[model samples]
Target: MSSNPGQEGAVAHHEHESREHASHEDAGIGRFFFGHVPEGVHGGLKQYGLLAIFLAIITFVEFVIILPEDLRGSSIVIAPLVILSVIKFFCVVAFFMHLKFEHGLLWQIFVAGLVLGLIVAIALVLLFGVFRPTPRAFSEGRQQPFVHHVEEAPHYEPLVVPTPAPLGAIAPAPAAGAAAGASPGQQIFMGAGGCSACHAIEGLAVGALGPDLTHIATVAESRVPGQSAEDYIRESIVEPDAYTVTAADEGIDQDFQQGLMVATTSSLGLTDEDVDELVEYLMTLR
Candidate 1:
């Protein structure tokens, strides 16, 4: 049947309306993902070049402040560094990541995560001393003074000692100078060894996760073939599972299961020099 001309016109109008609606929907989606750059946004960005310059300067200052050795352990240095890091983080989030234009819900989620992390850190500081073990005076290596030292050698000598030598002097008479020979080892123990954080002995400071190892070398030796006491300790730090002494055997109450000590080869990024220092210091535990 032939359609009336008016009806044909109405059908064409409906089709045109449908096409227009589709076009509007498509435009809306495009705008949501790729925000429209205004006709002269480039000019506005040029005007905002000062913002970029200021940000660059801030970054440079942060780097310079952090690079100086004197800034280490200084509140003056740490405070600015933290502030710069926070600023940088926000800048990237706002500009590069476009978080500034994001919905409030997303921002809330991000802020919540940051707050939670800070809370956990504070809690750790209260409970476990900032997620760091307390440094022991004497760690797996190094000897302390006034501790019971019963030797099982042929003589079975019992040497009662007073306070250790001054921080600079050697306790025993050794050919190697105390300060010069043991300096690297001490640095490694404090740095790479990750000691001096928790445990405390009369002379040395080491993490308290384990026992004070003052005279560990003299008191403890390796039962395994081809392994010295020094080797045993180093291996234990690198891989705690390679050797395991029962808590009862070690005269400790806590029984260490598998995977107790976290491997820090990746985290601390120990170099050969660092390892050597650590080994040298550990051997001096006697």
Candidate 2:
């Protein structure tokens, strides 16, 4: 049987139409999902594998950086880790999330969202004083003064009158006035002054947020060229930012961060007497 030319032309036309329709549908789907990908930019399996390898290497480096105790405690390790993390984040978002292939408007939106999230996180941290150390109460109530009890003599000697010695012996200087105990300054330190929040004293306050004040009195005079120990202690309470402490100064593992202490004594509700008491107590740490 001979084929008809008209029928053959009709079949060919139908096939062409079907192919065009399928092509249009595929192009529409691609635009919907990937947005407008620029020419010559392709994310294939090989590219993904390379990114994965890069990320793994970064992770390994981060792990290695934190292995040393001293480095881990210092900002030298923290800063590099933060930078590496940000790089990894961008790589994942641009390639895996296809943000790089998408429109500029999507990128703008993503960046705005990221900036807003960071602002909120920082605000919350400040509001909650997350980095500030909390003051601890050393005792529930005022500590009792230590008293030395003297035991009664085992047996009283029978009454015997001895002649009194001649006057002007000076009575041994009244036994040096029986060393005074537990000053009001100590109370303020453990209470209103909030000194225990950031400072540490060997057998007293245990706070570790700021410098170790165990020997603050001994070192205070040398901290400034002309400042006395009492003056230094007083100034530290009134104007905390006047001088900053470092690891070298304190012979410690890490330096105390600046601006962590309350800016003013008023913020702590410390009166002049309270401050004085706190200074006195701290000076006695030596």
TM-score of each: 0.33, 0.40
lDDT for each residue of candidate 1 in 39-155, tens digit (9 for 90 to 100): 222234653566577689998998788787976779999898888877777766654554443333465677789889999988977876645566552342344345357655343
lDDT of 2 at 73: 66
**What lDDT score goes with residue 22 in model 2?**
24
TM-score of 2: 0.40
Runs of candidate 2 exceeding 4 Å displacement: 1-182, 264-266
Residue 104, candidate 1: Cα error in Å is 35
Off by over 4 Å in 1: 1-182, 198-201, 223-226, 263-265
**lDDT values, one for every candidate:** 0.54, 0.63
lDDT of 2 by residue, 149-215 (tens): 9555444344332232211221222112211455777656544455655566776655677787888
RMSD of 2: 22.6
TM-score leader:
2
